[model samples]
Target: MRVLVVEDHEELAETVAAGLRREGMAVDLALDGPTALERAEINGYDVVVLDRDLPGVHGDQVCRTLAAGGSRARVLMLTASGTVADRVAGL
Candidate 1:
């Protein structure tokens, strides 16, 4: 499977990418929302591991753009916030 890891935390992103690579999945990294959108547009990703509080365009916008663009890749949003509202809003 091809996966894009969209995270602002460089170390964590690299680590996750490396682990996914080790598991035999093709992986790419994007540190911000804009870069993530660019890569997603250019690449055939099966999954997008997105960080909700991303810089540049914000994760919600990224997901919206992808959906609007008719992307087939599945998006999995990650966030530090654990509040009920945050979770509901993310959904």
Candidate 2:
């Protein structure tokens, strides 16, 4: 499966990509929201792992924009902001 990881934390992004690669998945990394959105728009991915907070744009905005734009890839948000409101807001 091809996955796009959108994260501002460099080490965490690298770690996640490495782990996904070990699982035999194709992975691409984007450090912030604009790059993430651009990459997602151009590539057909199986899943998108997005951070809740980002630079250039917030991850929540990216998720909403992608959904609004009719992106078919599944999104699984990975964020440190673990709260009901935060999760709901991302959706």
Clashes of 1: 0
Error of 1 at 66 (Å): 0.4
| Candidate 2 pairs with clashing backbones | none
Top candidate (lDDT): 1
Q: Residues 1-91, candidate 1, lDDT per residue (tens digit)?
A: 9999999999999999999999999999999999999999999899999999999998999999999999999999999989999999899
Residue 57 Cα positional deviation in candidate 2, in Å, after optimal superposition = 0.9
Query: CA lDDT of each candidate?
Result: 0.96, 0.92
Worst lDDT run of 10 residues, candidate 2, spans 82-91
RMSD versus native structure for model 2: 1.0
Per-prediction TM-score: 0.98, 0.93
**lDDT at 21, model 1:** 98
Candidate 1, poorest ten consecutive residues by summed lDDT: 51-60
* Model 2 Cα lDDT, one tens digit per residue, 1-91: 9999999989999999999999999999999999998998899888999998899999889988889999999999888888899877866
